[model samples]
Target: MRTLSRECGVTDADNPWLSRPVAPQPSAPAYTGAPTARPTGPSAPQRGVPAPDRAALLPTIDQRQDADLWWLGAHGGAGETSLAALIPGWPAAGHGWPRTPGAAPARVVVTARSSMSGLRAAQTSATQWAAGLVPHVQVLGLVLIADAPGRLPRPLREFAQVVAGGFARTWTLPWIEAWRLGEPPALTAAPREVRRLVDELSALLRPGADGTAN
Candidate 1:
Protein backbone atom coordinates (compact mmCIF):
# COMPACT_ATOMS: atom_id res chain seq x y z
CA MET A 1 0.00 0.00 0.00
CA ARG A 2 1.29 3.48 -0.82
CA THR A 3 1.69 5.84 2.15
CA LEU A 4 2.02 9.60 2.65
CA SER A 5 5.09 11.16 4.30
CA ARG A 6 4.82 13.23 7.50
CA GLU A 7 5.53 16.48 5.71
CA CYS A 8 2.73 15.84 3.22
CA GLY A 9 0.17 15.99 6.03
CA VAL A 10 0.27 19.66 7.00
CA THR A 11 0.03 22.78 4.94
CA ASP A 12 2.81 25.32 4.20
CA ALA A 13 4.68 25.67 7.50
CA ASP A 14 6.02 29.12 6.66
CA ASN A 15 2.42 30.24 6.22
CA PRO A 16 0.40 28.37 8.81
CA TRP A 17 -2.73 29.73 7.20
CA LEU A 18 -2.22 27.38 4.21
CA SER A 19 -1.67 24.32 6.41
CA ARG A 20 -3.62 21.27 5.22
CA PRO A 21 -3.33 17.49 5.20
CA VAL A 22 -1.34 15.93 2.43
CA ALA A 23 -3.48 13.67 0.25
CA PRO A 24 -3.20 9.96 0.99
CA GLN A 25 -4.03 6.98 -1.13
CA PRO A 26 -5.69 4.92 1.58
CA SER A 27 -6.61 1.25 1.24
CA ALA A 28 -9.54 0.53 -1.05
CA PRO A 29 -11.58 -0.56 1.97
CA ALA A 30 -11.02 2.77 3.68
CA TYR A 31 -13.68 4.38 1.53
CA THR A 32 -15.75 1.34 0.69
CA GLY A 33 -19.43 1.19 1.64
CA ALA A 34 -22.56 3.23 0.98
CA PRO A 35 -23.82 3.91 -2.54
CA THR A 36 -24.72 7.40 -3.67
CA ALA A 37 -25.86 8.38 -7.16
CA ARG A 38 -24.66 11.34 -9.18
CA PRO A 39 -26.86 14.05 -10.59
CA THR A 40 -26.95 13.89 -14.37
CA GLY A 41 -26.70 16.57 -17.03
CA PRO A 42 -24.00 18.95 -18.19
CA SER A 43 -22.26 20.80 -15.41
CA ALA A 44 -21.33 24.33 -16.26
CA PRO A 45 -17.58 24.59 -16.63
CA GLN A 46 -15.64 27.28 -14.82
CA ARG A 47 -13.07 29.32 -16.72
CA GLY A 48 -9.35 28.69 -16.16
CA VAL A 49 -10.12 25.36 -14.49
CA PRO A 50 -8.59 22.29 -16.13
CA ALA A 51 -10.46 19.53 -14.35
CA PRO A 52 -10.43 15.91 -15.41
CA ASP A 53 -13.31 15.14 -17.66
CA ARG A 54 -16.35 14.17 -15.58
CA ALA A 55 -17.18 11.01 -17.54
CA ALA A 56 -13.63 9.76 -17.11
CA LEU A 57 -13.43 9.96 -13.32
CA LEU A 58 -16.46 8.25 -11.77
CA PRO A 59 -15.62 6.97 -8.26
CA THR A 60 -16.89 3.79 -6.70
CA ILE A 61 -19.56 4.76 -4.14
CA ASP A 62 -19.09 1.63 -2.03
CA GLN A 63 -15.40 2.35 -1.53
CA ARG A 64 -16.06 5.86 -0.26
CA GLN A 65 -18.33 4.55 2.54
CA ASP A 66 -15.83 1.99 3.81
CA ALA A 67 -13.24 4.59 4.58
CA ASP A 68 -13.41 6.63 7.80
CA LEU A 69 -13.07 9.81 5.77
CA TRP A 70 -12.55 11.25 2.31
CA TRP A 71 -11.27 14.60 1.01
CA LEU A 72 -13.03 15.48 -2.23
CA GLY A 73 -10.44 17.77 -3.83
CA ALA A 74 -11.78 17.54 -7.37
CA HIS A 75 -13.20 21.03 -7.12
CA GLY A 76 -13.06 22.29 -10.72
CA GLY A 77 -10.00 20.14 -11.31
CA ALA A 78 -11.65 16.85 -12.06
CA GLY A 79 -15.01 15.19 -11.54
CA GLU A 80 -15.71 16.74 -8.14
CA THR A 81 -19.46 16.14 -8.25
CA SER A 82 -18.81 12.66 -9.58
CA LEU A 83 -16.40 11.99 -6.74
CA ALA A 84 -18.77 13.36 -4.07
CA ALA A 85 -21.44 11.03 -5.42
CA LEU A 86 -19.38 8.09 -4.20
CA ILE A 87 -20.52 8.76 -0.63
CA PRO A 88 -23.79 6.85 -0.45
CA GLY A 89 -25.29 8.66 2.50
CA TRP A 90 -26.28 12.30 2.33
CA PRO A 91 -24.68 14.96 4.54
CA ALA A 92 -26.02 14.99 8.09
CA ALA A 93 -28.81 17.27 9.37
CA GLY A 94 -27.47 20.77 9.78
CA HIS A 95 -24.79 20.15 7.21
CA GLY A 96 -27.23 19.25 4.47
CA TRP A 97 -28.70 21.75 2.08
CA PRO A 98 -31.39 23.96 3.58
CA ARG A 99 -29.57 23.27 6.86
CA THR A 100 -31.78 22.16 9.74
CA PRO A 101 -32.17 24.13 12.95
CA GLY A 102 -29.21 22.26 14.41
CA ALA A 103 -27.46 19.72 12.22
CA ALA A 104 -23.99 18.48 11.40
CA PRO A 105 -23.04 22.04 10.79
CA ALA A 106 -19.58 22.90 9.44
CA ARG A 107 -18.43 26.47 9.24
CA VAL A 108 -17.07 27.20 5.75
CA VAL A 109 -14.91 30.09 6.75
CA VAL A 110 -12.67 31.48 3.99
CA THR A 111 -9.71 31.97 6.30
CA ALA A 112 -9.16 32.62 10.01
CA ARG A 113 -11.62 35.49 9.73
CA SER A 114 -13.85 36.58 6.89
CA SER A 115 -16.31 39.43 6.41
CA MET A 116 -20.04 38.87 6.46
CA SER A 117 -20.31 38.89 2.67
CA GLY A 118 -17.86 36.04 2.08
CA LEU A 119 -19.44 33.84 4.70
CA ARG A 120 -22.82 34.47 3.20
CA ALA A 121 -21.57 33.49 -0.25
CA ALA A 122 -20.00 30.32 1.05
CA GLN A 123 -23.17 29.33 2.85
CA THR A 124 -25.23 30.04 -0.22
CA SER A 125 -23.05 27.87 -2.45
CA ALA A 126 -22.99 25.09 0.13
CA THR A 127 -26.79 25.09 0.46
CA GLN A 128 -27.28 24.97 -3.25
CA TRP A 129 -24.93 22.00 -3.55
CA ALA A 130 -26.46 20.18 -0.58
CA ALA A 131 -29.99 20.59 -1.93
CA GLY A 132 -29.24 18.31 -4.90
CA LEU A 133 -28.21 15.39 -2.66
CA VAL A 134 -29.87 13.13 -0.10
CA PRO A 135 -30.09 13.94 3.65
CA HIS A 136 -28.14 11.92 6.21
CA VAL A 137 -25.17 12.80 8.40
CA GLN A 138 -22.41 10.32 9.29
CA VAL A 139 -19.88 13.09 8.97
CA LEU A 140 -17.92 12.76 12.19
CA GLY A 141 -14.99 14.12 10.18
CA LEU A 142 -15.03 17.40 8.35
CA VAL A 143 -14.73 17.32 4.56
CA LEU A 144 -12.27 20.16 4.70
CA ILE A 145 -12.04 21.05 1.04
CA ALA A 146 -11.93 24.22 -1.01
CA ASP A 147 -13.63 25.11 -4.27
CA ALA A 148 -12.06 26.61 -7.37
CA PRO A 149 -8.46 27.35 -6.52
CA GLY A 150 -8.17 29.36 -9.71
CA ARG A 151 -10.60 31.87 -8.34
CA LEU A 152 -9.52 31.55 -4.70
CA PRO A 153 -9.64 35.10 -3.46
CA ARG A 154 -7.40 36.19 -0.59
CA PRO A 155 -10.22 35.99 1.97
CA LEU A 156 -10.96 32.35 1.08
CA ARG A 157 -7.34 31.25 1.57
CA GLU A 158 -7.40 32.69 5.08
CA PHE A 159 -10.72 30.99 5.76
CA ALA A 160 -9.19 27.71 4.54
CA GLN A 161 -6.46 28.06 7.14
CA VAL A 162 -9.00 28.41 9.94
CA VAL A 163 -10.87 25.34 8.77
CA ALA A 164 -7.61 23.43 8.51
CA GLY A 165 -6.81 24.17 12.16
CA GLY A 166 -10.16 22.86 13.34
CA PHE A 167 -10.32 19.60 11.35
CA ALA A 168 -8.35 16.42 11.88
CA ARG A 169 -8.15 15.75 8.14
CA THR A 170 -7.73 17.89 5.05
CA TRP A 171 -7.35 17.18 1.34
CA THR A 172 -5.55 19.67 -0.87
CA LEU A 173 -6.57 19.25 -4.47
CA PRO A 174 -3.74 19.63 -7.00
CA TRP A 175 -5.79 21.04 -9.84
CA ILE A 176 -6.70 24.27 -8.08
CA GLU A 177 -3.07 25.25 -8.16
CA ALA A 178 -3.04 24.41 -11.81
CA TRP A 179 -5.92 26.82 -12.24
CA ARG A 180 -3.78 29.59 -10.76
CA LEU A 181 -1.35 28.89 -13.57
CA GLY A 182 -2.80 27.82 -16.90
CA GLU A 183 -2.01 24.10 -16.50
CA PRO A 184 -1.74 21.27 -13.96
CA PRO A 185 1.19 20.96 -11.58
CA ALA A 186 3.80 18.49 -12.76
CA LEU A 187 3.97 15.18 -10.88
CA THR A 188 7.18 13.18 -10.57
CA ALA A 189 6.90 9.42 -10.65
CA ALA A 190 10.01 9.14 -8.47
CA PRO A 191 8.85 11.64 -5.90
CA ARG A 192 10.79 10.08 -3.00
CA GLU A 193 11.51 13.32 -1.20
CA VAL A 194 7.93 14.58 -1.50
CA ARG A 195 6.43 11.24 -0.46
CA ARG A 196 8.26 11.34 2.87
CA LEU A 197 6.38 14.48 3.85
CA VAL A 198 3.07 12.80 3.01
CA ASP A 199 3.85 10.00 5.45
CA GLU A 200 4.41 12.44 8.30
CA LEU A 201 1.14 14.25 7.72
CA SER A 202 -0.83 10.99 7.57
CA ALA A 203 0.55 10.07 10.97
CA LEU A 204 -0.97 13.20 12.47
CA LEU A 205 -4.42 12.19 11.20
CA ARG A 206 -4.56 9.18 13.48
CA PRO A 207 -6.39 9.25 16.81
CA GLY A 208 -4.52 10.07 20.04
CA ALA A 209 -1.67 11.69 18.14
CA ASP A 210 -1.94 15.48 17.91
CA GLY A 211 -5.13 15.26 19.99
CA THR A 212 -7.06 16.34 16.90
CA ALA A 213 -9.31 13.30 16.76
CA ASN A 214 -12.68 13.41 15.12
Candidate 2:
Protein backbone atom coordinates (compact mmCIF):
# COMPACT_ATOMS: atom_id res chain seq x y z
CA MET A 1 0.00 0.00 0.00
CA ARG A 2 1.27 3.50 -0.85
CA THR A 3 1.24 5.76 2.21
CA LEU A 4 1.11 9.51 1.65
CA SER A 5 2.82 10.46 4.91
CA ARG A 6 6.00 8.68 3.88
CA GLU A 7 5.99 10.04 0.34
CA CYS A 8 5.10 13.59 1.39
CA GLY A 9 7.76 13.83 4.11
CA VAL A 10 5.12 14.02 6.85
CA THR A 11 6.87 12.25 9.71
CA ASP A 12 5.41 12.29 13.17
CA ALA A 13 8.32 14.41 14.30
CA ASP A 14 7.47 17.08 11.74
CA ASN A 15 3.70 16.76 11.84
CA PRO A 16 1.81 15.72 14.93
CA TRP A 17 -1.19 14.69 12.87
CA LEU A 18 0.76 12.14 10.86
CA SER A 19 1.41 8.69 12.25
CA ARG A 20 3.11 5.49 11.22
CA PRO A 21 1.13 3.27 8.88
CA VAL A 22 -0.33 0.10 10.28
CA ALA A 23 0.59 -3.10 8.51
CA PRO A 24 -2.24 -4.91 6.75
CA GLN A 25 -3.32 -8.09 8.43
CA PRO A 26 -4.70 -11.42 7.29
CA SER A 27 -8.31 -11.56 6.16
CA ALA A 28 -11.18 -12.39 8.50
CA PRO A 29 -14.74 -13.61 8.07
CA ALA A 30 -17.30 -11.07 6.95
CA TYR A 31 -19.58 -9.92 9.79
CA THR A 32 -23.24 -10.54 9.12
CA GLY A 33 -24.42 -9.74 12.63
CA ALA A 34 -26.71 -6.80 13.25
CA PRO A 35 -25.32 -3.55 14.63
CA THR A 36 -26.33 -2.54 18.15
CA ALA A 37 -28.81 0.29 18.57
CA ARG A 38 -28.35 3.49 20.60
CA PRO A 39 -30.83 5.68 22.43
CA THR A 40 -33.36 7.41 20.17
CA GLY A 41 -34.65 10.94 20.64
CA PRO A 42 -35.69 13.92 18.59
CA SER A 43 -32.56 15.80 17.49
CA ALA A 44 -32.74 19.57 17.41
CA PRO A 45 -31.82 20.97 14.03
CA GLN A 46 -28.98 23.46 13.62
CA ARG A 47 -30.17 27.05 13.31
CA GLY A 48 -29.35 27.74 9.66
CA VAL A 49 -29.28 24.27 8.17
CA PRO A 50 -32.38 23.00 6.38
CA ALA A 51 -33.87 19.70 7.49
CA PRO A 52 -33.19 16.83 5.14
CA ASP A 53 -36.07 14.71 3.92
CA ARG A 54 -36.42 11.83 6.30
CA ALA A 55 -38.83 10.24 3.82
CA ALA A 56 -36.14 10.12 1.18
CA LEU A 57 -33.75 8.22 3.44
CA LEU A 58 -32.16 5.18 1.86
CA PRO A 59 -33.67 2.02 3.25
CA THR A 60 -31.29 -0.11 5.25
CA ILE A 61 -30.84 -3.68 4.08
CA ASP A 62 -32.27 -4.75 7.43
CA GLN A 63 -34.24 -2.33 9.51
CA ARG A 64 -33.77 -4.47 12.59
CA GLN A 65 -29.97 -4.28 12.27
CA ASP A 66 -27.91 -1.15 12.84
CA ALA A 67 -25.02 -0.04 10.68
CA ASP A 68 -21.37 -0.78 11.34
CA LEU A 69 -20.33 2.51 9.75
CA TRP A 70 -21.87 5.51 8.01
CA TRP A 71 -20.69 6.48 4.55
CA LEU A 72 -20.87 10.18 3.70
CA GLY A 73 -20.18 11.83 0.38
CA ALA A 74 -17.62 14.63 0.31
CA HIS A 75 -19.25 16.19 -2.74
CA GLY A 76 -21.97 15.54 -5.29
CA GLY A 77 -21.49 12.51 -7.55
CA ALA A 78 -18.82 11.13 -5.26
CA GLY A 79 -20.22 7.60 -5.65
CA GLU A 80 -21.69 7.54 -2.16
CA THR A 81 -24.95 5.88 -3.22
CA SER A 82 -23.23 3.32 -5.40
CA LEU A 83 -20.76 2.45 -2.68
CA ALA A 84 -23.45 2.30 -0.03
CA ALA A 85 -25.32 -0.19 -2.17
CA LEU A 86 -22.15 -2.04 -3.14
CA ILE A 87 -20.74 -2.19 0.38
CA PRO A 88 -22.49 -3.36 3.52
CA GLY A 89 -23.22 -0.29 5.63
CA TRP A 90 -25.46 2.70 6.18
CA PRO A 91 -25.09 5.55 3.72
CA ALA A 92 -25.60 9.16 4.79
CA ALA A 93 -25.15 10.47 1.23
CA GLY A 94 -24.19 14.13 1.83
CA HIS A 95 -26.90 14.47 4.38
CA GLY A 96 -25.77 14.90 7.98
CA TRP A 97 -24.81 11.97 10.15
CA PRO A 98 -27.31 9.19 10.88
CA ARG A 99 -29.63 10.49 13.59
CA THR A 100 -32.18 7.70 13.69
CA PRO A 101 -32.84 6.80 17.31
CA GLY A 102 -30.95 3.53 17.52
CA ALA A 103 -27.53 2.12 18.08
CA ALA A 104 -25.42 3.56 15.24
CA PRO A 105 -21.73 3.15 14.65
CA ALA A 106 -19.69 6.21 15.49
CA ARG A 107 -17.17 5.43 12.76
CA VAL A 108 -17.61 7.27 9.48
CA VAL A 109 -15.96 6.91 6.07
CA VAL A 110 -16.03 9.84 3.64
CA THR A 111 -16.06 9.29 -0.12
CA ALA A 112 -14.92 11.52 -2.99
CA ARG A 113 -13.60 11.35 -6.52
CA SER A 114 -9.87 11.50 -7.29
CA SER A 115 -10.29 14.87 -9.03
CA MET A 116 -8.83 18.07 -7.58
CA SER A 117 -12.13 19.53 -6.43
CA GLY A 118 -13.24 16.25 -4.85
CA LEU A 119 -9.92 15.90 -3.08
CA ARG A 120 -10.21 19.42 -1.72
CA ALA A 121 -13.69 18.75 -0.39
CA ALA A 122 -12.51 15.49 1.14
CA GLN A 123 -9.53 17.21 2.74
CA THR A 124 -11.76 19.87 4.22
CA SER A 125 -14.12 17.25 5.64
CA ALA A 126 -11.23 15.26 7.05
CA THR A 127 -9.75 18.38 8.58
CA GLN A 128 -13.05 19.28 10.13
CA TRP A 129 -13.56 15.80 11.51
CA ALA A 130 -10.02 15.72 12.90
CA ALA A 131 -10.60 19.05 14.65
CA GLY A 132 -13.77 17.63 16.27
CA LEU A 133 -15.98 20.03 14.34
CA VAL A 134 -18.17 17.11 13.27
CA PRO A 135 -19.52 15.87 16.55
CA HIS A 136 -20.31 12.24 17.36
CA VAL A 137 -18.73 10.91 14.17
CA GLN A 138 -15.14 9.73 14.07
CA VAL A 139 -13.73 9.85 10.56
CA LEU A 140 -12.07 6.51 9.91
CA GLY A 141 -10.43 7.69 6.67
CA LEU A 142 -11.21 8.48 3.04
CA VAL A 143 -12.45 6.43 0.06
CA LEU A 144 -11.41 7.97 -3.25
CA ILE A 145 -13.25 6.81 -6.37
CA ALA A 146 -11.17 7.11 -9.50
CA ASP A 147 -12.27 9.85 -11.87
CA ALA A 148 -11.45 7.69 -14.87
CA PRO A 149 -9.76 4.52 -15.93
CA GLY A 150 -5.98 3.93 -16.00
CA ARG A 151 -3.33 6.14 -14.40
CA LEU A 152 -4.14 9.63 -13.18
CA PRO A 153 -2.49 12.76 -14.49
CA ARG A 154 0.57 14.07 -12.61
CA PRO A 155 -1.24 17.10 -11.21
CA LEU A 156 -4.22 15.07 -9.96
CA ARG A 157 -1.93 12.42 -8.54
CA GLU A 158 0.06 15.05 -6.67
CA PHE A 159 -3.13 16.57 -5.33
CA ALA A 160 -4.29 13.13 -4.20
CA GLN A 161 -0.96 12.64 -2.45
CA VAL A 162 -1.37 15.87 -0.52
CA VAL A 163 -4.95 15.01 0.40
CA ALA A 164 -4.02 11.50 1.42
CA GLY A 165 -1.23 12.90 3.58
CA GLY A 166 -3.84 14.63 5.72
CA PHE A 167 -5.47 11.35 6.71
CA ALA A 168 -4.03 8.27 8.34
CA ARG A 169 -5.59 5.96 5.76
CA THR A 170 -7.22 6.21 2.34
CA TRP A 171 -8.68 3.58 -0.01
CA THR A 172 -8.85 4.16 -3.75
CA LEU A 173 -11.52 2.41 -5.84
CA PRO A 174 -10.82 2.03 -9.53
CA TRP A 175 -13.26 3.16 -12.17
CA ILE A 176 -15.80 0.46 -13.00
CA GLU A 177 -17.19 0.46 -16.50
CA ALA A 178 -20.03 -1.84 -15.53
CA TRP A 179 -21.10 0.51 -12.77
CA ARG A 180 -21.37 3.38 -15.23
CA LEU A 181 -23.73 1.21 -17.23
CA GLY A 182 -25.94 0.81 -14.12
CA GLU A 183 -25.04 -2.75 -13.31
CA PRO A 184 -25.01 -3.97 -9.72
CA PRO A 185 -21.69 -5.00 -8.23
CA ALA A 186 -21.06 -8.67 -7.63
CA LEU A 187 -18.18 -10.08 -5.62
CA THR A 188 -17.11 -12.42 -8.39
CA ALA A 189 -17.21 -9.59 -10.93
CA ALA A 190 -15.30 -7.05 -8.80
CA PRO A 191 -11.66 -6.29 -9.36
CA ARG A 192 -9.02 -7.71 -7.04
CA GLU A 193 -8.42 -4.33 -5.45
CA VAL A 194 -12.14 -3.86 -4.85
CA ARG A 195 -12.39 -7.26 -3.25
CA ARG A 196 -9.40 -6.51 -1.06
CA LEU A 197 -10.99 -3.25 0.06
CA VAL A 198 -14.25 -4.98 0.90
CA ASP A 199 -12.40 -7.61 2.87
CA GLU A 200 -10.46 -4.97 4.79
CA LEU A 201 -13.63 -3.08 5.61
CA SER A 202 -15.43 -6.24 6.62
CA ALA A 203 -12.61 -7.07 8.99
CA LEU A 204 -13.04 -3.68 10.58
CA LEU A 205 -16.71 -4.30 11.42
CA ARG A 206 -16.15 -7.72 12.87
CA PRO A 207 -15.21 -8.07 16.53
CA GLY A 208 -11.69 -9.33 17.42
CA ALA A 209 -10.62 -9.06 13.79
CA ASP A 210 -7.08 -7.86 13.07
CA GLY A 211 -8.23 -4.68 11.34
CA THR A 212 -6.52 -1.37 11.99
CA ALA A 213 -8.41 1.88 12.59
CA ASN A 214 -6.75 5.01 11.22
Candidate 3:
Protein backbone atom coordinates (compact mmCIF):
# COMPACT_ATOMS: atom_id res chain seq x y z
CA MET A 1 0.00 0.00 0.00
CA ARG A 2 1.17 3.49 -0.73
CA THR A 3 1.92 5.47 2.41
CA LEU A 4 -0.45 8.32 3.17
CA SER A 5 2.49 10.71 3.13
CA ARG A 6 3.22 9.67 -0.45
CA GLU A 7 -0.41 9.94 -1.50
CA CYS A 8 -0.59 13.42 -0.01
CA GLY A 9 2.55 14.49 -1.86
CA VAL A 10 4.37 14.90 1.42
CA THR A 11 6.94 12.28 0.49
CA ASP A 12 8.22 10.50 -2.62
CA ALA A 13 7.46 6.78 -2.94
CA ASP A 14 10.75 6.13 -4.71
CA ASN A 15 12.90 8.80 -3.18
CA PRO A 16 16.53 7.89 -3.86
CA TRP A 17 17.58 10.49 -1.33
CA LEU A 18 16.06 8.48 1.51
CA SER A 19 17.83 5.25 0.59
CA ARG A 20 20.45 5.72 3.32
CA PRO A 21 20.74 7.68 6.53
CA VAL A 22 23.57 10.14 6.99
CA ALA A 23 24.88 11.48 10.27
CA PRO A 24 25.54 15.20 10.43
CA GLN A 25 29.20 16.15 10.80
CA PRO A 26 30.13 18.69 13.44
CA SER A 27 30.45 22.27 12.17
CA ALA A 28 34.04 23.27 11.39
CA PRO A 29 35.65 25.79 13.72
CA ALA A 30 35.64 29.41 12.55
CA TYR A 31 38.89 30.48 10.91
CA THR A 32 40.90 33.30 12.45
CA GLY A 33 42.27 36.14 10.26
CA ALA A 34 45.82 34.64 10.22
CA PRO A 35 46.73 32.60 7.12
CA THR A 36 48.68 29.31 7.38
CA ALA A 37 51.37 27.98 4.96
CA ARG A 38 50.44 25.07 2.66
CA PRO A 39 52.03 21.66 3.38
CA THR A 40 54.57 20.32 0.78
CA GLY A 41 53.47 16.65 0.69
CA PRO A 42 52.23 14.26 -2.02
CA SER A 43 48.40 14.40 -2.54
CA ALA A 44 46.60 11.25 -1.38
CA PRO A 45 44.50 9.23 -3.92
CA GLN A 46 40.67 9.65 -3.50
CA ARG A 47 38.81 6.49 -2.55
CA GLY A 48 35.18 5.38 -3.16
CA VAL A 49 33.09 7.53 -0.81
CA PRO A 50 29.34 7.80 -1.32
CA ALA A 51 27.91 11.27 -1.90
CA PRO A 52 25.70 12.37 1.00
CA ASP A 53 22.03 13.05 0.33
CA ARG A 54 20.48 16.08 2.04
CA ALA A 55 17.01 14.59 2.48
CA ALA A 56 18.51 11.49 4.08
CA LEU A 57 19.88 13.64 6.89
CA LEU A 58 16.47 14.93 7.93
CA PRO A 59 14.66 13.34 10.89
CA THR A 60 11.70 11.01 10.46
CA ILE A 61 8.79 11.48 12.85
CA ASP A 62 6.50 8.61 13.75
CA GLN A 63 3.35 8.97 15.81
CA ARG A 64 3.79 7.73 19.38
CA GLN A 65 1.24 8.69 21.96
CA ASP A 66 -1.37 6.90 24.10
CA ALA A 67 -3.86 9.73 24.30
CA ASP A 68 -4.89 11.56 21.09
CA LEU A 69 -8.49 12.38 20.29
CA TRP A 70 -9.84 13.76 16.97
CA TRP A 71 -13.16 15.51 16.74
CA LEU A 72 -15.01 15.94 13.45
CA GLY A 73 -16.66 19.29 12.91
CA ALA A 74 -19.59 20.05 10.61
CA HIS A 75 -18.78 19.58 6.96
CA GLY A 76 -17.74 22.55 4.72
CA GLY A 77 -16.41 25.96 5.68
CA ALA A 78 -13.12 25.96 7.57
CA GLY A 79 -14.09 22.58 9.02
CA GLU A 80 -11.66 21.49 11.73
CA THR A 81 -8.68 22.97 9.88
CA SER A 82 -9.38 26.24 11.62
CA LEU A 83 -8.17 24.57 14.80
CA ALA A 84 -4.60 25.47 13.81
CA ALA A 85 -5.50 29.11 14.21
CA LEU A 86 -7.48 28.89 17.46
CA ILE A 87 -5.23 27.56 20.19
CA PRO A 88 -4.13 30.18 22.67
CA GLY A 89 -0.46 31.28 22.56
CA TRP A 90 0.49 28.84 19.78
CA PRO A 91 2.73 30.26 17.08
CA ALA A 92 1.53 30.31 13.44
CA ALA A 93 4.28 28.30 11.83
CA GLY A 94 4.82 24.76 10.49
CA HIS A 95 2.28 22.54 8.76
CA GLY A 96 1.67 20.16 11.65
CA TRP A 97 0.74 20.67 15.32
CA PRO A 98 1.94 23.88 16.93
CA ARG A 99 4.92 23.88 19.26
CA THR A 100 4.16 24.12 22.95
CA PRO A 101 4.86 27.52 24.47
CA GLY A 102 7.83 27.75 26.86
CA ALA A 103 5.96 29.90 29.38
CA ALA A 104 3.82 26.98 30.61
CA PRO A 105 2.84 23.46 29.61
CA ALA A 106 -0.23 23.62 27.44
CA ARG A 107 -2.92 21.44 25.89
CA VAL A 108 -4.62 21.61 22.47
CA VAL A 109 -8.41 21.72 22.29
CA VAL A 110 -10.28 21.28 18.99
CA THR A 111 -14.02 20.73 18.58
CA ALA A 112 -15.74 19.42 15.47
CA ARG A 113 -17.87 16.55 14.07
CA SER A 114 -17.08 16.02 10.42
CA SER A 115 -14.87 13.70 8.43
CA MET A 116 -12.68 16.66 7.55
CA SER A 117 -12.36 17.15 11.26
CA GLY A 118 -10.36 13.95 11.43
CA LEU A 119 -7.83 15.20 8.89
CA ARG A 120 -7.56 18.53 10.63
CA ALA A 121 -7.19 16.78 13.96
CA ALA A 122 -4.23 14.81 12.62
CA GLN A 123 -2.66 17.97 11.22
CA THR A 124 -2.80 19.53 14.68
CA SER A 125 -1.65 16.46 16.61
CA ALA A 126 1.30 15.57 14.36
CA THR A 127 3.73 18.18 15.68
CA GLN A 128 3.46 17.47 19.39
CA TRP A 129 2.85 13.72 19.22
CA ALA A 130 5.52 13.15 16.57
CA ALA A 131 8.12 15.04 18.60
CA GLY A 132 7.06 13.25 21.82
CA LEU A 133 7.39 16.54 23.70
CA VAL A 134 3.80 17.15 24.76
CA PRO A 135 1.79 15.28 27.34
CA HIS A 136 -1.09 12.91 26.56
CA VAL A 137 -3.89 14.94 24.94
CA GLN A 138 -7.65 14.46 24.99
CA VAL A 139 -9.44 15.15 21.66
CA LEU A 140 -13.01 16.25 22.41
CA GLY A 141 -15.70 16.41 19.72
CA LEU A 142 -19.09 17.99 20.32
CA VAL A 143 -21.16 16.24 17.70
CA LEU A 144 -23.97 18.55 16.77
CA ILE A 145 -27.22 17.00 17.93
CA ALA A 146 -29.21 16.62 14.78
CA ASP A 147 -32.76 15.36 15.28
CA ALA A 148 -31.86 12.47 12.98
CA PRO A 149 -28.12 12.49 13.17
CA GLY A 150 -27.75 9.17 11.41
CA ARG A 151 -25.29 6.47 12.36
CA LEU A 152 -21.95 8.02 13.22
CA PRO A 153 -20.37 8.91 9.89
CA ARG A 154 -17.37 6.86 8.79
CA PRO A 155 -14.89 9.60 9.78
CA LEU A 156 -16.33 9.81 13.30
CA ARG A 157 -17.52 6.22 13.72
CA GLU A 158 -14.12 4.99 14.87
CA PHE A 159 -13.81 7.63 17.57
CA ALA A 160 -17.48 7.24 18.55
CA GLN A 161 -16.87 3.55 18.93
CA VAL A 162 -14.04 4.27 21.31
CA VAL A 163 -16.11 6.72 23.31
CA ALA A 164 -19.77 6.15 22.43
CA GLY A 165 -20.10 2.40 21.95
CA GLY A 166 -21.70 1.09 18.68
CA PHE A 167 -25.33 1.92 19.28
CA ALA A 168 -26.04 4.97 17.10
CA ARG A 169 -29.13 5.92 19.08
CA THR A 170 -27.46 6.02 22.47
CA TRP A 171 -25.93 8.99 24.24
CA THR A 172 -22.59 7.84 25.55
CA LEU A 173 -20.39 10.11 27.64
CA PRO A 174 -16.88 8.70 27.41
CA TRP A 175 -15.29 12.07 28.18
CA ILE A 176 -17.41 12.49 31.24
CA GLU A 177 -16.61 9.00 32.41
CA ALA A 178 -12.91 9.65 31.91
CA TRP A 179 -13.13 12.92 33.78
CA ARG A 180 -14.79 11.14 36.68
CA LEU A 181 -12.22 8.36 36.72
CA GLY A 182 -9.05 10.50 36.40
CA GLU A 183 -8.45 9.44 32.80
CA PRO A 184 -8.15 11.88 29.93
CA PRO A 185 -11.59 12.31 28.33
CA ALA A 186 -11.93 12.56 24.55
CA LEU A 187 -15.60 13.09 23.61
CA THR A 188 -18.65 14.63 25.18
CA ALA A 189 -22.39 15.18 24.55
CA ALA A 190 -24.57 18.22 23.67
CA PRO A 191 -24.11 21.98 23.90
CA ARG A 192 -24.98 22.25 27.56
CA GLU A 193 -22.11 20.00 28.56
CA VAL A 194 -19.34 21.23 26.22
CA ARG A 195 -17.88 24.03 28.36
CA ARG A 196 -17.81 21.81 31.42
CA LEU A 197 -16.29 18.96 29.45
CA VAL A 198 -13.51 21.12 28.01
CA ASP A 199 -12.79 22.55 31.44
CA GLU A 200 -12.54 19.09 32.92
CA LEU A 201 -10.37 17.80 30.09
CA SER A 202 -8.10 20.83 30.39
CA ALA A 203 -7.67 20.26 34.09
CA LEU A 204 -6.91 16.62 33.47
CA LEU A 205 -4.16 17.66 31.03
CA ARG A 206 -2.67 20.12 33.51
CA PRO A 207 0.70 19.06 34.91
CA GLY A 208 1.01 17.74 38.46
CA ALA A 209 -2.76 17.69 38.86
CA ASP A 210 -5.47 15.11 38.31
CA GLY A 211 -9.06 15.90 37.43
CA THR A 212 -11.90 15.40 39.97
CA ALA A 213 -15.42 14.21 39.37
CA ASN A 214 -18.58 15.60 40.97
In terms of TM-score, the best-performing candidate is 2
TM-score of each: 0.28, 0.66, 0.30
Q: Model 1, residue 192: displacement in angstroms?
A: 9.5
Model 3 CA lDDT for position 22:
26
Position 102, candidate 3: lDDT:
38
- Rank ordering of all candidates by TM-score, starting from the highest: 2, 3, 1
lDDT of each: 0.29, 0.58, 0.28
Which model, 1 or 2, shows the larger TM-score? Answer: 2
Candidate 3: TM-score?
Answer: 0.30
Inter-residue clash pairs, candidate 2: 37-103, 38-102, 38-103, 40-101
Instruction: Score candidate 1 by lDDT.
Output: 0.29
Model 3 lDDT on a 0 to 1 scale: 0.28
Question: Which lDDT tens digits does candidate 3 get at residues 80-190?
Answer: 333222222221122222233233222333332334443333333322232233333222222332212345556465443332211111122222333334443222322
lDDT of 2 at 192: 78
Question: What is model 2's C-alpha RMSD?
Answer: 11.5
